[model samples]
Target: MTTASGGMTTEQLREHVATTLTRGRERTAALIEVEPDELTAQHSTLMSPLVWDYAHIGNQEELWLVRDVGGRDPVRQDIDQMYDAFLNTRASRVALPLLDPTEARDYVRTVRDKVFEVLERSPLAGRRLEEGGFAFGMVAQHEQQHAETMLATHQLRAGAAVLHAPRPPAAVVRLAPEVVVPAGEFVMGTSTEPWALDNERPAHTRNVDGFAIDTAPVTNGRWLQFLLDGGYDRPELWTTVGWAHRVQAGLTAPEFWQLDGDAWSRRAFGVLEPLVDDEPVVHVCFHEAQAYARWAGRRLPTEVEWEKAARHDPATGRSRRWPWGDEDPTAEHANLGQRHLRPAPVGAYPAGASALGVHQLAGDVWEWCDSGFTPHPGFEVFPYEEYSKVFFGGDYAVLRGGSFGTDEVAARGTFRNWDHPVRRQIFTGLRTARDLTAAERG
Candidate 1:
């Protein structure tokens, strides 16, 4: 093994690649370990069957690592289009000649074994994709992303509680209602991250005027107040598009929430429990979050503002890799990697706070930003264009920070996630921000 790109030796890169792949597999197993094969069937039209995602993960590894990177013969060339996401829609995928659960497990195992063999021999430095071991990292991140998708399907599936984990730690610090971020220029994306995908590339300087953003995400308790105040009923609080969508969808509260008499409860992985006041609200769509921000006389932060708050260190005037620092995330930093079933209570993970005093910026729930999805200044299509180039438009709203379901490999300060604004199935939430008054900025 020798040094290649990103200043890391091939041995170090290989370890990282192996560790990431192993963790992704472990997570996939945990999500489906006890569920019967029938449970893996198409649970929602919005998402592919668990079995499809299962084999797709393996298929991608075989395509990229085993075949492309290693120059090996195809393992299952017949099923290439069967698992091609661009070729098949999620709703229609159930009708495809998909692999059974047993077959899926075996196929993934076989592909992974081949991958390991290739990984050991490859220099991981020659081609563009091999530079910095990007392909390996990309595949690992892809699997983790699918794992999170599977977790979402599990949440949508109806059943008694099948998943359990310890509750996130209680809040250790009391944060202010809002923090003022002075007007300034900050780097918004990543140019140096070896594993960062195309949309996050070509880091650029962005100048944002002074604004005051919520110290933490909007909480369920505050949302309860909005609901009680007829927030949904008040069309004035919602944009014309949002109000129309709300009416059509009949969205009265966050997904999984249930009301009984005077109290509210939420369903988590099949268990119904009283909603906690302090935990950040999850499963809310961009429309819901935007409406709530409007009702509160604020708005969701732009993607740039979100990144600045999560990465900027005031003293050094530089962006840190994460809110806590450039160091890799640990359990102490934030709630991530399915370590918990839900978001941590607000004010938790004070150690995860950025230099500007922001908290929970790394994980908990995906926070919706006001910005629409687009490319950076110097964006270019890489290994493939379908991964991000197809989604570069205003149709998709951006979300920053990872969720409790997100793995560290797929979550970083500069990482970008975007989806249709009406989507609520993802683990999504929001934190509000407002422009500073003249006196305040002065």
Candidate 2:
């Protein structure tokens, strides 16, 4: 049976959609101002031309809300062909007949206006979005996700940084090496989160063995040790496929780093500076994370282990929505929502610690887990399968925790982010774990 999470009214949902939609628009507008030419430029094959993102957001709103739910006429049926992501490759998108920036903005405005009308008329109580105002929440989160993607394009773009957000505060204290999570059964995923996407649905029990995980993310200084120790040159430390790719890509360091003689620096946004020693390492692929763990005599946590460490309250046998409990995230909880341009230092947020005292489980960076992307036992695709189902069972790795680019409204301890094992442009990081047995040891 599909049931809705309680405690929110339709009016509250309405206002939330209005507010969040505006925020996404403001961010998108500010991003285009970086350099009009850059927005149209395809910075990398990994991302679409900026103008495509602009129109695609509006087109999605039209497809899901105005036309699909409201039974309204299409806003710009002709242009839908040009913006379909599944049909158009990122490389191919740049040459498509995309709308100009001015036309794109107008399209987004018109679609949002129609969507608000649909929200007003629809009874948000029968199914899907109606079941829990989920559609509205989904739309808001979608736009925010795109905004983060656009920020990635900005990072890859050549020019002065168009994006500007304060860096998170420095770490003030040291982290304990690891936190021990006692073995037991714990609930995973959720059936009650109003805005949860389909892949995270149908909360269920999972039995995880006892393990110890890092109390904080691996810092740049700590990762530097792996590099200095020749971790990359040792094929024995990396998987055969990973070793092959490492040599192919010339993977000496994280994506944005540059080694100069005896010194090291990395590019953040538009400027290059010496690496912050205490900050969590970002932009590392899973292969690199796996290699570092081997060098350090540890391992990456499995996705289930990752969740139990971050969510299981042994005292109550219940999971928290976030590391700090059932409450939603705030500025004090973690570094998120693009509020910062970079990860905070390793031990930055004591207040955000999990029940077991594991810190930084909520944000700063999305931590890679040692699991491939898959589905829950009772999974059912809602809205569409393309969002999550299509990506299942691929050569993808699951990443837990949100990132500095993550919008808190879209993040929860149960939330999931997945990508190819070789992706490094994302705000990705790692925290080492180890099995509580001898044979598992390397």
Candidate 3:
């Protein structure tokens, strides 16, 4: 099994750290000229001040992983006292000394240099270096997370013009209406795999019955049909919780889409664009997804069903990391890393389809599931205390797959992400499933 840094060769560790640092530097350079005042000009629910967030990324890595645990001191030690999210209210506005954007960039570079020097000087053959390797892993992941957050900040700060919309593929591929999954026992959640997050641990076996899942995610056109059919207007289609959520938000349609006369258009990035009829519907909340599924005579897959279908079955030659196989993600294969910065037409990446013939299972937009955020049995918290435990009973729902902004590591199948049911800011959407017995036969 691949360990985070435990079993890695010193050369491997050096290469990983160098590559991660290069990525971080590139992301930092991208936002150096973004006007700070412009970033804070609007009350965007989707973003924070670009400069502030940029500094916070470095501060978090240095404070939490290096200084706090690695027994090193921060170059700007006062940052620890000022920007610690655990100590300061995340939502409360506070006046504090902040570096100019350029200064912040310099500080990050200085920290990176120090980290690189330390790694270079460390003795390779010992547990001490291994501990350093682990610390580097933590820092690398911390920066990866900030990379995603920074992308969101960029979209909000630079407006829609800066974020490119994905062009429709030259040809559209319509998937089979449904794929039938046979009833059987399958191992649910992560096993003794290499480097799984805490939430995916304590893998257990689960028994499931035959079910039919949509071959592709629900599309904007399909969801619009539901909306026009009074899907949201009818209370019968919504759960009690869902109805309340819809009422509170006063949502008549997906957050980004609107009906102009008889034509449908949506706010792409920050500008209005004609809705691509075949693109997978995105930015819809889980409540909306649930209601739409109910209206369409289907349901969201339980986490077990999703996992079983997306992963491979040992007995059936179906075991693969992604739906397509154990290959690394490529630009042509999945809509991720802001490659197109917009949701693509469903089934655009036939190469990314899962074992059950499900398309876009790993990337495009994050798909909401029917499961709540809870620990698997024998689950142990990771060293990062608040990552999972803080949100266990919160009003959040589980979203699988990574979105356009998600990094390759976070986009792993075992990675679990959750947000409140009302969050529609992120690139979130859904697919539907139905019990075989309840499926409307053609």
Candidate models: Cα lDDT each = 0.90, 0.86, 0.71
Kindly list the per-residue Cα lDDT of model 2 for residues 408-427, writing each as its tens digit: 76678888999999999998
Report the candidate with higher lDDT, 1 versus 3.
1
In Å, residue 78's CA in model 2 sits off its true spot by 1.0
Clashes of 3: 4
At residue 366, give the lDDT of candidate 2.
89
Please give, for residues 78-117, the per-residue lDDT of candidate 1 as tens digits.
8999999999999999999898888888998999999999
Worst 10 residues of 3 by lDDT: 123-132
- The TM-score-based order of candidates, best leading, equals 1, 2, 3
Deviating ranges (above 4 Å) for candidate 3: 1-8, 31-33, 40-42, 68-70, 93-97, 121-134, 154-160, 165-172, 191-194, 314-319, 438-442
Model 1: how far is 336 from its true place, Å?
0.7
- List ranges where model 1 is wrong by over 4 Å: 1-7
Output the lDDT of residue 253, model 3: 90
Better of 1 and 3 by TM-score: 1
